[model samples]
Target: MNQVTNHTECSSLNNAKVAIIGAGVAGSTIALRFAELGINTTLIEKGPSLVNGPPICHLHAGGNLYREISDQQCLTLLQQSIDTVKVYPQCVNVRPTVVALPLTDKGEPQDLLPRLEMLRDKYKALVQQNPSNEVLGDPQHYFRLFERADLERIAQRELPKKALCDEDWLVAFAKQVNFDKLKFPLVLVQEYGLSAFRFAAIVSLAIERLPACTLQTNSRVIDISAKENGAGWQVTTAVNNDDRVNTAHYDYVINACGFKSGELDDMLKAKRQRMVEFKAAYVAHWPQCQGLWPEVVFYGDRGTPQGMAQLTPYPDGYFQLHGMTQAITLFEDGLVASCEQSAQPKLPARFIKKIDHHWPEQLVNDRTIGNIAHIAQFIPDFTQAITAAKPLFGAQQIPGDDPDLRAADVSFHESGYARAEIVKASSALAAADAILEDLLESGLVTSALSKRYLNEHYFPVSLQCQADEVTARAEQLAQERNYPIALANIF
Candidate 1:
């Protein structure tokens, strides 16, 4: 077992109690930040464990996947992703992502150059501010471009025994992709992967170690009513398989309930606009490959027949695949929104079942096979892949009606109440920081800035050195959660 030392205990400064209802990415990050400051925090989750809401494998270092969004959002994502990498270094799969545009794509390679250059400059500045921020490698080599001819020649080279460089990582992909079907040039960016299981273990460990933070798993918040005389908020919770319900009081309450956040909003008699989207990624095994492959993105129009396709590689020949098409990763009626009836979005029954991780066996196999066939279009050899595990699927909450909203932070619903709406896992830290600022401003948490040093020095580097125990716990979580053990591994 990993031992997280008792951090600061600032309860004496101001015995402020905080209740965060949800242990997903946002809620977990918030709880840790509060615990680090020695604030009394209760992190409640309805699930069997933490961070099981969605499958997050890709770290959007620069919002590269969403070309339609603004450059500001891209910059914000880059900054937030860097912070996340520093916090949970073990969860990051340290490999570059190969981004290719198919011949049918309307976008040209030059369309990416400006943003790439801007991101590179920003990365350089960040690293200059702190040398330790170079988690994605040197800023000068932030991204590499390869022409069709270059890939054609590299494809003829022998497979590498072990990938040592970015070029080495690209060998397997270069050998497989059909250049005839792609545009002239492709680019590789310094993006990484986030193993959801590993992240869960890290956050769970961090929470359990802090004396100020209480992790309540299998506990659901059934009601949230304001306390009499407006002294504080009253939280009613129901534990798993327990006949009795428990009530608690807190100075502040946070609604971080992944897709069910609006339920809390409704309970507080506040209506807000939000949308829920159901998506999935299939797990497949292709043992025929001899070399390691980095994450790959094939861009296309989403929700169409030839939508954006993603291939995420893991150890031992396992790969997680996603296709933005309806028949593959997306489904009809998978997205719904709130009306005047209630604040929660009403997803169809099929999506809700999948969100509960109860997909029919035949449907899982069909989608896995479809994902394999789709990848085979680019890499003809991928047809030999077989389903390895159940699809990682869940519904995500988008703050507003626009599902394209990728950047989000803490929203003050009312006094003594905050709501976090993060569209991507990378935004977790930013959202947490916002709540921390709120705490400081409201005089709820009074830690000397120098005493706390809420910068990069918050988490001790010594704790991160205990990777063996973290990995062990992560693997156990994967098995107990009915996921392939390989999914817990850092690819």
Candidate 2:
């Protein structure tokens, strides 16, 4: 096929051979969609596409999990977000029971009933019904929306409760206002294993639909250039140990490489983007000495300098304590786990330090064999919950590689960063406040996000460890180990 410039020719892209980069959810799904329309599509992934293959560093699945956007125009974005989050379900631990804490005499902890009044008073809701609407509170509020009450009730009876302080022991029993696990769902668990499992499942949902997407592991996209005709783009990737260079051309390219997307923009001389990095870590724990309870328990910190840790269910038969502020061991199998010490879309160094210090000694390498086993052994119920959600099948194979290798390579260079996001008027992210607006219109999103249970109650507690302390301790550790450290926050 020759390079064509006619708008009429390209607009009818059906049956046109399409090339996509990064088989991660976005690229793979796009290829599948094109193939469904009878368009021949080739998906190019720089990593092994198989589920158990080499691990790839990807985006954190937060917005993907709890987003309330449901519009068709917003579906693509929502699907992509959910796909990313689902990849690490076990790690995104969801608490079945959210027990509110009340201060008692002698600094004891009291379990306050989970009430609708608490939701109403703590969370501001501009209830949307038909034509009526209002903005009652902020959107950062955190509330426990239960999806499976009966299951929770059963689990509550079986699980053991963890107290924040040694002085408290009287655990109260009450139902919290939450969505049915069969209906409105809360997926992010703040724990480790289940969160990871869930993330994987969501990614699988999108990948399974693509029958013609090819994933090439250990392939790094080194350069991307546009042709002189402006009809297409060329991407040069370095494959394997041979340093072999393979160039593939595409009529269009979607930049979904997360933090590294800036490099592609530079190579293509296209629009530039900015990304921050953060230092994120997770600590999974199970008691070394198994406790008597068969159910999972959750605890909240009444007085804390930073975010409080949550003790929740994990797979295999143990509990996991993890959060943004503080992480602790709850059961015999508990292990301190760090997902990664650095992340792109970086957080401030001081902020990272604050968060890291919250973990005392349970900081284990997240990918280590021992830590993985401990989580699997202790969190049995969590394991069952995650396994049930993951589909047994895998994605269909990518199409053949025979026809397009002879195409000429295109050359290009970086111009400058895009001052404004240049998107089609119909593009899903065209609006400046696309995320907020979509939720507002959907009725699912409300000022309730800024409520005490959601924001003040949940958000601050999550950030208890603060980024500042984590970095400070990390620096000290590096100094003691005689290892020079970079003081930058990696996202």
Q: What's each prediction's TM-score?
A: 0.96, 0.41
Give RMSD (Å) of candidate 1 vs. truth: 2.1
Off by over 4 Å in 1: 1-13, 449-457
lDDT of 2 by residue, 1-491 (tens): 12122212222323333455554433433343333322345656565442221112222112111112222313333222232222222223322233321121121121221222233332233233211211211223322333344335533542245633211111222222222211222221111112222222333333344343344556778887777776566777888566689888765455444333444555654432233222232323333423222122222232232222233343333333332221212222111111122212233444334333332222344322222332333233222221111111111111112211111111122221111111111111121122223323433223433121121111111122233443454344334433222211111
Q: Give the Cα error of residue 79 in candidate 2, in Å.
A: 9.9
lDDT of each residue in 113-225, candidate 1, tens digit only: 99999999999999999898899888999999989888878888888877677788888888888888899689989999999988888887777677778988889889889
| Per-model CA lDDT versus the true structure | 0.85, 0.31
Stretches of candidate 2 off by over 4 Å are: 1-13, 25-39, 50-195, 198-210, 271-273, 287-305, 308-312, 318-321, 325-491
Q: What is the C-alpha RMSD of each candidate to the true structure, in Å?
A: 2.1, 18.1
Worst ten in a row by lDDT for model 1: 1-10
